[model samples]
Target: MSNREGEGKLIQVKGLIKKYGKLTAVNGVNFTVNKGEIFGLLGPNGAGKTTTIEMLVGLRKPDEGSATLGGYDVVTDVGKMKEVMGVQLQATSLFELLTVEELIEMYGSFYKKQVDIEHLIESMMLLEKKSDRVKNLSGGQKQRLAIALALVHDPDVVFLDEPTTGLDPQARRVLWDIILKLKEDGKTIVLTTHYMDEAHVLCDRIAIIDQGEIIALDTPEKLVKLLHSDNAIEFRVIEGELNWNELPNVTKVTKKSNYIYIYSSNLQETLSHLLFICKEKSIIFQDLHIRAATLEDVFISLTGRRLREE
Candidate 1:
């Protein structure tokens, strides 16, 4: 690992490749994350998100290529890199006997620098449960404790893998607020999530990865635009053999039950064409709706399949 002189980017990955025997987990993945930005690495399960992050955190070395965190090569400077990075993996377990505060202190001791435990506890809203053993805490509380352990070192970069998984709505909201607070504190975050809304709300830019490669990388808005499905027209079809392919600006059409969903970039044109077709075919519909396209649509367009399906 080598550092670039006077560079400000917090993370830079160039042509990174990682293999596990016959399988390639991450293949030629390249992207840079600027300082203090929430860069999301998003994909479905088994999309190499975890593999890429493991390499970034120096837990697993790459088979080929280079990745640098804060200008330090991850593989060569594993010790130094670990010191500067705080990580919360998908499954964070703790000794059943350890209290919240004790666990935080234990993790903090590994760092050369000291962190403010009292302040961190207060900020994380763990004061009430600080003395409770790890086994006695709720799922949200455990996740929060894991986050506290990661931050107790005062690292420059933090990686969260599926932080909100298995969390209830209220717990997810609390986690979101905590993430936003981290951003406000000028910490650079690199996270992976299967939630489209989370990526849309939390990340400044996201790379949509799949099949061991980055298929799309951009701001969420730009990604929607690039796919030409930024907005869509959706409604239930009463009955008819409507020629959906003939509709203007209709790039694709999906039919389910009694519903006909149209993917289009020009909403007005598509709606106009759709209405004309419906009238010509004497089709009736109920509960028609129009809305802007989302990251889910972008993912589907790129993969030709839905997120849940993948």
Candidate 2:
């Protein structure tokens, strides 16, 4: 597939590939992140999101293709990576013995260009905990601090790999605000997240990767627009097996365990037909629900599996 039209492109990746012995972990992937925009890699776990980020950040050398961040060739300009971007991995080993302010200062000391420490602490919502030890901070606090360290040097680009993976909704929102503020402050961001809702809300454009290949790439609205169905009528079958796809006006159907989801082109007509069929067949169904098609539905249409499905 062709890449997006180039305009304000901060990062360009062409035919990027990676291999692990006999396994090709990342296929010939291609995409570009626009300047000051939030570009996301949206996929399930082990879908090569982390591998792509590693190669872009210069932690791992790509076996093929090239990527450029801030006009610096990611392949040949390994030493200049730190000058252009800041990264927060899935897990960061913080100096547990040190206080939050100390850790922030330590990271800033590594770079000649540094943002104000007070502002960094306040912005990450760690102002109250600045004097607290890293070991004493909560799980959410540690994650915030990790990101704070990433921003201390105030690089033009930021890379976050599943930043809100294990956080609660509230903590997740806090992190989300930080990300949004980064964009508002004219910073480019490359984020990798598996949560469809998160990607929908936070990303300007998402590249949906699976099995090391990008299956889809577009804004959240455009990706959802790709779905053939406008509405989804979801329910659970209490008993009996039926050909759900045979239902009228159904663009697609997916059944997981007892739950069946019918993606319908015409919602009211399809719903009426569904009820008629269930009654005629004497099929028991419960928890009937109807909603608009979303990113998960888009993934289902493309891959025939749920976003978080293993």
lDDT of each: 0.86, 0.89
State model 1's lDDT. 0.86
Indicate which candidate wins on lDDT: 2
lDDT of 1 by residue, 1-310 (tens): 2355315688999999988889888999999998889999988998999999999999888889998898789999888778778999997778779988898888888888857998999888889998999899988888888888889888889999999999999999999999989999989999899899999999999999988899999998998786567677778876777777688887777665566668886889989888887887798887898988888777766776665562
In model 2, which runs have C-alpha deviations exceeding 4 angstroms?
A: 1-7, 241-246, 256-258
Position 67, candidate 2: lDDT: 90
State the lDDT of candidate 2 residue by residue for 1-310, as single tens digits. Answer: 0243333777999999999998898999999998889999999998999999999999999999999887778878777768768999997899999999999999999998999999999999999999999999988899999899889988888999999999999999988998999899988999999999899999999999999999999999999878677788888888866666657888878767667778888999888878888888888889999999899988877887888975
Worst 10 residues of 2 by lDDT: 1-10
**Every model's TM-score:** 0.89, 0.93
Q: Name the lDDT of candidate 2.
A: 0.89
Off by over 4 Å in 1: 1-6, 234-241, 249-261, 265-269, 279-289
Q: What is the C-alpha RMSD of each candidate to the true structure, in Å?
A: 2.9, 3.4
